[model samples]
Each structure stands twice: as structure tokens, then as C-alpha cells.
Target: MESKRSKYILIGLSVFCILLIGITSFKDGFLNPLRSGVGYVLSPIQSGVNRVGTSLYNGISNYSTLRSAMAEKQALQERIDALVEENSRLQSEQFELQRLRELYDLDQDYMQYQKIGARVIAKDSGDWFQVFRINKGSADGVQVDANVMAGGGLVGIVTDVGAHYATVRSIIDDVSRVSGMAQQSGDTCIVSGDLTLFGEGRLRLSNIAENGDLKDGDRIVTSNISSKFLPGILIGYAADITTDQSRLTKSGYLIPAAQFDSLQEVLVITTLKEEEAPQESTENTEGAQTGA
Candidate 1:
């Protein structure tokens, strides 16, 4: 019975509070401090919750933007790499085209001789193109003792020829010996290859006439007496002419006209001198008989 009486007292208090709120809404109380106090307390809490929501949203948005920027940067870098590779390929092709054009001009200049252009396939492991191989041989009208020319002058002789390739022994080789003469004075001299002197881009010239009037910077060319090379092929310029110890002959250095440092393409004169052709045939026949 006492529990029942307590429950009734609580219900009565709740009704009284409701009636007071209704009276405040109708402005029945002076100043209405009840509504004013509730408003003042709840406003700051609602504002705090809204600010936290906005900050979380902005942070997620910024993270998405950063990821997008990284992806774009990676794509741009790949594109730049591809462009650089393409540029290198174009430059290589341009150089090859230029080299072919220069060879064409040389072919025209030596129109009197029958020439077949061939690319340098291999070179000696030394500092010079002393002994190099070309991409032409017996099948292409190339033969042993055939003269090779490049860069406007004699380079070497085709010393060995196979079915599809030939080996050249350049004038710069230590064993090379070419008979040449001073273009100005017709003074015959032997251009002998000396490995030591070749290091300075020079060849030994011997057997020159003491009174040949050969001087420094005189043009030297292949003599008609050369066994393998053709006549009148520009060898190089003569320099430092001096009387040899024998006093009867003069000697000097000959700077070769052809740049033996770089050999890319060459012209092989197809025709062997008429006198050498028979001897070459005779040698080949003799070698075949001996093998048999």
C-alpha cells in the first residue's frame, strides 16, 4: 500500500512539469527563464558535433586528391621515357643516312673505275684499321690484291678474299710497303709502315732521290711501279724530308690522306691490273694442284 502511494506522487510531479512548460510556451510566466536556460545550454553541444563532421569529410576529400596527383605524375614520367627513346632512334637513322650520301658522292667522283661499295664488317683489335674485313669477296668481283679506297684516297689492299668477305691490309700495317712518289717532283719513295711511327700518324718514306726537291707538305701519291695498288692514288702529304745515313737516298714521314682511325664503308676497284691477273690465276691453279 505504501508503494502505491509513492508511485502516485511521482506521476503528479511529471504532470506539474508538463503544465509549467505549456505555460512558458504561452508566455504566461514573466521572463520565461526555463526555456531560455535550456536553449543556452544545448547550442554549444550541437555546434561542436557539426564542426567535427565537417573536418572528417574534408580530410577524406584531401586524401582522394593526393592519390589522384600521384597517379598522374607516374603516367607523365612513363610518357617522357618513351619520347626520349624515340628521339635516340631518330638520331641514329639520321647518321646512317648521312654516311650513305657521302659514299654516293665518292662513287661519282671515281666514276672512271668500277667500284662496289661494301661496309666494314670487322676491324683489327688494334688502334688502327691495320687489318680489317669488308662485306665483299670473290663473289662480288673482289679479289686478293684488289685496291681499296675511302675518304678520297687509297686505304689498303685486299690481301685475302673468301666467298663473301675480304680482309684488307691497310698501309698503316707494320708489314705494309707501298711505292709512292712526290707529286711535285716525281721523286720515287717507298712508304713503309712502322708501328712506332704510326702511333704519331706517320709512315716511313725511303729510297727518295736526294735531289728530288721533296719538302714538307708535298703531296705524295701511289707510283705506277706499285705491284698491287693503282697509279695516281693519293697516299698522303710528305713531311720532315732528310737525307738518310747512306746520303744517296732521302727519307721522310708521310701523313696518310685516308683516315684509318674510322673505316665504315669502302670502294673496291673490280678490275685487277692486266699484268697481275695472269699471275693470280697461276697461283690459284698451283695451290689447287698442290692440294690434290
Candidate 2:
């Protein structure tokens, strides 16, 4: 009996809805109360659907705005990084220029000698001051036996040359030997590089005459008798002189004037020393002596 009653109520509601629509189409104001009641029943569902749509639209808009802002920030950060790198590069270039200028001034001071400038390209693979390569070589008129000098004094001599580079064996190398003299007392000595004396940055000066007044702080210069090096080039100062076991001659340490470890640029003298020629006897003199 309850089921039958529910079916009847549903059927009555359908009829009521159709009648309400017909009345509304006829423009009848008398059914306003019924329309008001039905509108009130549906209002809450419409409001809920509108709220959900607004919430979804707002979420999408916020996500788009955040993505755009992040992209802009990343682009700006990349640009800032590029600018910083460029600044560092420029600073390094400026420092290099200053160093080259100092080298140029040094070359100008030795204008009396025919000189060529070269940049240090490489250092010896094994030791610090054993050997180094210069950017200039045969193509730049650099040849074997060219004297190399640094800030303080004579550094070494060129031993090998290539098309674009030259190798110099510094005076500190074990293979190097130079004829040196005490500038003050004219004492002659042989300066040789020894591995044992490398820690003191000095070379062994031997063969000083026993009677020679060799003293500490005496300046040592390259002697004219040296075949490879030019005459009168400053080499170093004397230190720790003492008699050898044989007591036949004095020996000491020569502190090198040139700072081999800090060498960056150098000048290679191109002019060779003029050689003196032997005088020839006249043929008339020989004939006169024979006739006499």
C-alpha cells in the first residue's frame, strides 16, 4: 500500500510540472507563488556548480602566472652569469698587458744591442729552471747560443731552436757552466750548476786563486774569456767562500742575479761580435829578404 501511494505522488508531481510550464507559457501571473517555490528549491545546486567552476578557473590562472615568472627569473640569472664571466676575462687580459709593458721597457733599456722579444711558451717538464721554451725561434731569427736574460741578470743560453719556438737551458741546470769573475778583485772562477746547491738558488764557483782576496757580497760577472756568453754581464754575488780539501784554490757559492723562476719575457741579441782577421805579409817583403 505504501509503494502504491509513492507511485501516485510521482505521477502527480509530473502533472504539476507540465501544468506549471503551460501556465508560464500563457503569461499567467496567478501561478507566481508556485514558480517562486520551485525556483527556491533549485537555487542552492546552481550556486554550488558556479562556485566549483570559479575555483577551477582561479587555480589554472595562478599556475600560468607562476610558470611565466620562473622563466623570466631564470633568463635574468643566466645573463648575470655571462656578464660575470666576461668581467673576469677582461681583468686577466689587463694584468697580462701590464706585464708585457714592463718587458717592453726592459728591452728599450738595452737599445744599444740588437734585440728581439719573445714570450715564454713552456717550462721544462722535469725541473723548475732547467729549461724553458720561448715563442720565438728560427723564424724570428733566434739561433743557437743566444744569451737569455731576465730581470736581475744573465739567465741562460739558447741550446735549440725550432720554427716557432726555442729552448733555453738556464744557468741553474746541472749541465750548464759559465766562466765568471769577481768584479772587485778580478778573481777568476768557474760557476757550475749543481743539484745540491739548487735549494739556495746559487751555483758553485770554483777555481778561485788561493791568494785572491775573495770576500762575501762581491759581485760576480761573466768574464770576457767565456766563449758563449757576452762579456761583463752580471751573474751574481759571492757567498760562503772557503778553502777546498786540497787547499789549492778557494770555492764558494754564487747567488744568481736573474730570478729564473719568475722569467716571463726576454730579449735575444742578434748581432754577433766582430772577429779580428790575421794580417797578411806583402809579397814584396818576401822577395826583398830573398834577394838580400
Candidate 3:
């Protein structure tokens, strides 16, 4: 039955084509209007299909361009971030180099003493360096009572020593008392720590002579009479010296030479105050035996 239906359809299409030919032959112009009518009806439909195809092609092209642009922008941003980080690292290293150079000069000034460099690993609570830990210890010739310094002058004394680390008690600590002598007139004074007023970065200077020639900005150095500190180490300048009401002694504030808050690296002088005395005694004993 399907084959018979197909055969009838084919015959019908053949007859319709013959009819069209015959009509066209009849007047030579009968088929012209029909052709024109078909063309007029299909023009808008053809245009619509072309427009749809063009829109699809343009959309795909624009999407690809947008993706490429976005990828390029992401790559550039990552490169910029990497460069910024590298620049920051370089700047930090430059600053550290400058500080180490300053410390090198300070070390040269004390050529008589054996020294080692140590980085500060920890600090005590507060704005001041009341106590801090360094990377060097007894194994590095850093014994308890060893003198520590940085920047321009004396910083602290080693209070504890371990195999690989040491602890320092800065002169700005509450329990610190550094005997200071005036570099100008040899007048002696005491530099006592008082954190109650440490916010000013000044320690209490006292025990000055009533007629002391100490004036404002007189350089104070560690006194020879100091029990623990080596003499001649610069402390800081005297400021605001005022005699007590009794007039027997005077007291004032002293700004420390070391920047206590931002201490990063320090130098430890291995010589101890008590060690010098014993060595001197041994020398004296040998000299006496030789004399005998």
C-alpha cells in the first residue's frame, strides 16, 4: 500500500509540472506573474533567516574576544602583584643594610673588647626593652654580665645565658641603675629606671653634686665606679637637671642612646667587669713573685 501511494504522488507531481509548462507556453507570459508572486512572498522570509545566521556568528566572535581580554587582564594583574612584593622585599633589605653599617661603626669604637653580633628574638612586655632575648648565648662567649650595645652606645647587660641564647636587661628597665659620670667635669650621677615616666623615653638621673657643673645636653658616660658596666660607654645626654630642695643632690632625666622600642640587632662585648679585676690580680701576683 505504501508503494502504491508513492507511485500516485510521483504521477501527480509529474502532471503538475507538465501543466505548468503548458500554461507558460499558452501566452508566454502566464507564468511570469506567478513567479513574481512567489518571489514577493518569500523575500522577507529569506532576509529573516540571513539576519538570524549573521547574529549567531557575531555573538560567538564577540564572546571569544571578551574571554581573551579577560585572560590578558588577569595575567597583567598577577604580574603587577608579584612585582610589588619583590620591590617591598628589596626596600626592607636596604633598610637593614643601613642599620648594620651604623652598628659596625659603633663596634669599631670599642676595639679593645671582643664582640659578637646577635639578633633580638624577643622583647619584654611594654614600650621599652626592659628585657629581651638574643640569639647568641654562653656557647658564643656571651656570658652573664656581658655588656650589650647597639646604635651609638651602651644598651644593656646580659642577665641570663643558655647554650644557644641569652637574655639582656636594658638600662631602661624598672630595676636598672646605671652609674653615670659627666664627660665634661667628671661629676657622677645615677641613672635609675622608672617606667612610670618611660613614656617620655627618659630615665631618672640623680645623685648629682649640688654644685655639679652638669649643664643641659652634657654627655653622660658609664662611670669607672660602675660595678657591672664598663666605663666610658656613652649613655645619653643630661637634660632638665634641677637640684633637690635640700641642695645636697640633684636629679633630672636622661635620654638613652639606644632605641629601646625598635631594637633588632645588638652587639655583646664578652669582657665582664669582675673578670677584669681577677685578671689584674693574677698579673699583680706574678709581678710580686718576680720581684721577690
Task: Point out where model 3 deviates above 4 Å.
Answer: 1-51, 278-292
Write the residue-wise lDDT of candidate 1 on 91-137 in tens digits.
98887777677767767866767889999999879777888999999
The TM-score-based order of candidates, best leading, equals 3, 1, 2
- Tens-place lDDT per residue, model 3, 1-292, is 9999999999999999999898879866767898899999899889998999999899899999999999999999999999999999999999899889978999899887888999999887777677889999988999887889998988988888899999998887777778789998999888877677778878889889999898779999988777777888999989999989998988898988888888899999999877765323322111111000
What lDDT does candidate 3 reach at residue 58? 93
The candidate with the higher lDDT, 2 or 3, is 3
TM-score (all chains, Cα) for each model: 0.72, 0.63, 0.80
**How does model 2 fare in lDDT?**
0.76
Q: Tell me how far the alpha carbon of residue 115 in candidate 1 is from the true structure, in angstroms, after superposition.
A: 0.8
User: Could you tell me how far off, in angstroms, the CA of residue 166 lies in candidate 1 after the best superposition?
Assistant: 0.8
Assess each prediction's global lDDT (C-alpha) against the native: 0.80, 0.76, 0.84
Which lDDT tens digits does candidate 2 get at residues 1-292? 9999999999999999999899797775766778888889879888998999999899889888889989999999999999999999999789678666766765665565677888888886654666888899889888777777766577778888898888888888876788788888888888887656777778888888888987789989877666666666778999999998888999989898877766777777654422211234322211111000
Worst 10 residues of 1 by lDDT: 283-292
Of candidate 3, the 10-residue stretch with the lowest lDDT total is 283-292
- The candidate maximizing TM-score is 3
